[model samples]
Target: MAGNVQGESQFDVIVVGSGAGAMTSALVAADNGLSVLVVEKSDKYGGTSSISGGGIWIPNNHHFAAKGGKDSYDKALQYLKAATGGVVPETRLRAYLDNAPKMIRHLEAKSRVRYAVAEKYPDYYQHLAGSLPGGRTLDPELFDTSVLGDELPHLRQGAPSNLLMGRIAWTARQAHKAMSREFGWRFMVLGLMLRFKLDFKWRRKSKFDRRAALGTALIASLRRSLQDRKVPLWLKTEFRELVVDGGRVCGVRVVREGREVEIRARRGVIFGSGGFEQNQTLRERYLPQPTQAGWSATPPGNNMGAALEAGIAAGAATALLDKAWWAPTIRVPKEEKPRGVFAERAFPGAIVVNGRGKRFVNEAAPYLEFVEAMYKDQQASGAKSIPAWVVFDASFRFNYAMGPLMPAQIMPDSRLRKEWLGTVYWKAPTLAELAAQIGVDPLGLEETARKMNEYARTGVDSEFMRGGNVFDRYYGDTNVKPNPCLAPVQKGPFYAMRLDAGDIGTKGGLLTNEHAQVVREDGLPIPGLYAVGNCSAAVMGLGYPGAGATLGPAMTFGYVAANHIAAAA
Candidate 1:
């Protein structure tokens, strides 16, 4: 039932999963004169890449060369070594550093994908030995979805948090500016809205914007390139197992249209089907305790680690099985997945607190570390921090967006749905009243607020050292002096939004080497078997160096895998 492209059971390379990494591998392999087939388990393509922020973190990128800004290999090496604590293989780290930029250049030159540097984004661990202030993250340019032709209807929609009104799209750079209410942001948004409204023809076709940005744009560009090459992307196909002959992965068994089909990959099979974060059994077995699959920001049930299990059956080793690309997210009414609270936590006039109504971690810390601190608090101090509250006041509500609630200017309390008041968000006029409504200690909440006020005045977070790093300050308001990340919660009408220890994806799966070849526990490479993306143990291990860390290594290694496959033959 699986109709092979060009009407054959064999392909030079077969890529599992249809995310950015899988598509990159397929496109690159096709460029190398190899026949390629891309398989997606779901009905739609793009995987989570379509809903993502689409920022690719590649240190020492071409932008630096163009601008005469130097990024030393030694320093990037230093930063990764410090950030990842040297648990990862040095060669694997070097492979990513060397090939990531090359992959970016190749995509721009050969494929529809185009990228521009995000100048303001900073490395999460700016204090680390080798991190840049910005320019390391490359944002994908907006792409016209019309290029995809009929494929446009099946593409995954961008997340609400990443879109303007959950319809129009904007690049990460533009989105951040508008969300922060930076200079001239209003005009930028107004122009985008006007463009969308003027496209009456596009409106008739779909409610979504024709101009794709963020993950959708990145995937759309790559998909367009793949279409040009006549690559076969099979939807509604479920990978059943890896087909092994003489201990080598020769092909894969999949169910297509309710019939089993065995497709041969002469070069190899690359698994990019993503991690098992959505599998509750795997989450309980591998990830930290008190974890819930619903809290995951990744597409539910999409990344159940079929490839990971298959790879393990093929004798592949794994590491970092307990780790994840952790983040804080808020679940909203009627939305299938939680909305990520990434940038909002760093804005001034807010703090994250456990049920004890005390600030346990720096509110502006990187999302991964923020959630890790929550678990640490829960375990070490027996604090109810798993479902910690982000408690702020009217000053914050007026100036900033919290989870699903936009700023008071755009989305006032009066506009909030009645069902969301006590569930999605909470509000009260006084500190005690707010604490009581949220079930936190009233005295503790009041005392924490008083301390925050003093800290705001002195421009110092004495306990947590917030606003002390370039990364945190980057997300802060420049108008708020002394420390951009510090502000008082003294205003009446306090507000609180619950946060979950969510993740973009899991960090562990099939272990791989520098060439991205699946390796056994004894470090022997498994011929004709490769892995990339979240299905492989993350290149950074437990460390999150900067924005787009997940997608960067995934794509870089996919390039590595493709080149290695091309060279092997």
Candidate 2:
């Protein structure tokens, strides 16, 4: 039976989708004494942001600057200028850089969330002029999900790569070392566990999850803050349409318990419902390439571009529609998962080859650059635009961590073997035989292997500058002598996996003014409508700067949006 309500439903603000932006907006609005209602489409909250590497890049942040790190509004601007290459407007970039530190402090101090700087992480454009070497990013201190109790089930666990949920984040070297000395490692781990149970105990500041497991932490922090203030969170409810009255957005049409209900928004309607990554039609039209979409890595209910489409229907302008936040992926058919091969080039003696069996680009370059090179490869020699193969030798498989492989099957073991899944690897005693099995040119594959073997012997990668960056080396094994990226894939049986240009999420959507007010086609604000996060076009335009770049601005703009609306009211 449909739940009954007596009074007309209303709130000072209505926030759709409980991602980073939505949750931040809701918490900020409620804290400011405005009655706030947060509506989530899924049965669970904590959208994609929760399931991500929880880093937020806030360059020249006050915390870092105070700690003797070099930064300023001008330097931050200089960095962005050097990184962007003039594709995005200077005004938007300036706004994001200027407001970053203040927004971080505002959320941390005002809400239950606490953040600490990730001093070791580097900007994607560290080689670019004015880019800082490290420590401009931050992530939340682990928060206890058990505090939510009944709400725990509704708070989604982010992807396995997130380390904070109990997964220890180790580089390829650490993992290899642990596996190499299994018995001693098990004994040491058991000792640590015993110590944890007996002598060594600290404040239960929640289980210390690393950056990978931070999605739930961030969401739980926001949820706890909201619940403490008595803000209503209506989950499993969807925003159907804009309840417009006399050309102004007065409220929203929401479906709750199989009934259409109207919830009046007296202050504003905030759209934080994430982007259109799962919309295959949108992908075909905008991205125009077929890669493993990595739907398993994505939060299941992210299918609807509710915020993007809804805002567009209301005539909100959009930008960066032609580009997406892209990453190079290896779709391992054996595991039926698309693993980000950040360490592939860094792995000893591994080189990536195309369908024609030739080294394309430096395997150790940033993933964005790698994917861009692959796109160029697709255009260069008339290869299939959708799927390319990343072939490595037996040593790479046995020695290094190629990418993230989920320990468990999303599909049952029986269903994973089906040909349609497309993530399987072909192993053969010879490179030629392996190529034939995978439908590639055997001679080309042999030539590519021979060249890589020569490079491995010489310790020189003349074709592509793999392992040229500190970021690459960080993901590589230091145990490899001379050059980590120069290991030849000589050990057979060789392996090949199909790869596609997958993405974290789409960055294109509604255009907004600096204050996060959705701008209309005629350059006027959409009255009572504010959009931030993935629902809106990112402030950095088409390029992603570094890890946590997406969430940093999303949270900042979310705080900005709430403040602007509250001030206007």
Candidate 3:
């Protein structure tokens, strides 16, 4: 299966994976006059990053400055300390902060990568010290995939759930309007309809959409930059072993198309092959029970931990293996992948309940916080909260979308006859019947519903403070009177979707220092080895500060790794 190769290839830097972090590292290394080779295990590039929201939380970014937003380094550090609680060393934290702006500038100057400030997106912990309401996160501008030419088909597509009309990409803010019935929204929807109609011809030819947004755009832009640099990217290449010589990682053995090949990395090998979220063995060994591969939002075959395993075998120390970028996800029977639900839980007329049919936390809380509450519930009572139910009434079903179930969209008769949907998504004419269908205590659900309805009537959630903060209110409906997040769940024909503990990816892997060099148990750098993205232990410790927390550090550390290698060279 080898394609006309008889011997080994060589490069100054060898990067594993083709996600944002890996591509950034490769591009930066190439910019520094290093010949870099990017090898991806999967047939396509981008990994899980292509399907993400493509937000990068870079404080003091140029976009923020361009928008006249004031952000100080000291204030950013204060926020980091408050969020991480001193768990992350000041040096590593400083390295991330100092390099983040540099990384953004470098990418914009050196490549086609460009970003716009998500001016209205708030930090997850907005009330915390040094936190801004917005202006820290950068979203990649939409990219035209037509530029990729033949490589377009090989690029990993964005998550289908994130797209609108199977091709158009909409941001959360855009979706808010598009879902509304306002005159402005109607005009926008009309425009989108026309665009989709015109795109039908292109879709027929390409078999995929050409307008890439969010993470898809981020990856496509990186791919274009890499192509311009003439960097060689080998797909279907699986890293087998790190070839170490005298305690230095000098080369790697990779299996490409069923044939093994040795490639020498003269300067360094950067591992950004993602986390262990898809590796069942590592997930069992590291994460808690019931939080394995099936529950992850990462694409299939991702985060298999091969890179981490190789690093560990080479004596690299690991950290934070028990943690992940947690999110609550619902498994749709018809969909091939589990969909991560965020805004739905925060909308009025809905509530999430555990097996005991009790609301344990504020439904309007951030997704990560919601999962943390679930974890807390599980710790209190084993497996009781693993499959929590997101209960909603007819009003909610008609007003808002939940996972794959669109607002006001009638379910087909064929799917309604299935028993699994009855089991997974309980629908009943009465609250007690819905509870019974989902195998919960009917009386308990009735009582929970009664209390929630009372809260809705009064516009107050005394029990868990459902709509207490700005962050909670971000996803709430503004039109609703009093508290936007409070609405009576008294409508008949209620529904419930089973939700499980899921994650964007595992957060733990090989430990790296300020320079992004993989460190051993002895606190010494594993020479010629570096790691970024989920393949490296996160610098945020265990706290998620804002949107794009995962990718911000990923790209920054990748930049750090490449610059260090270049400086040494």
* Candidate No. with top lDDT: 1
User: Model 3: per-residue lDDT, tens digit, 334-446?
Assistant: 55467788778888889988888888889878787788889899898653788789998888887877777767654532444475566457789999999888887788788
Best by TM-score: 1
RMSD of 1: 2.2
Please give the CA lDDT of all the candidate structures: 0.90, 0.70, 0.86
Candidate 1 residue-wise lDDT, 124-181, digit = tens: 9988777888878889999999978888878987787788887888888887787666
Give the alpha carbon lDDT tens digit for every residue of 180-226 in model 2. Answer: 33336556545434543442233243343322235567778888888
Per-prediction TM-score to the true structure, in the order listed: 0.97, 0.86, 0.95
- As for TM-score, the candidate ahead, 2 or 3, is 3
What local lDDT score does residue 512 receive in model 1, on the 0 to 100 scale?
96
Model 1, runs deviating above 4 Å: 1-8
> How does candidate 1 score on lDDT?
0.90
Residue 350, model 2: lDDT of 60
Give the TM-score ranking, best first: 1, 3, 2
User: Which residue pairs in candidate 1 collide?
Assistant: none
Q: Candidate 3, residue 310: CA error in Å?
A: 0.6
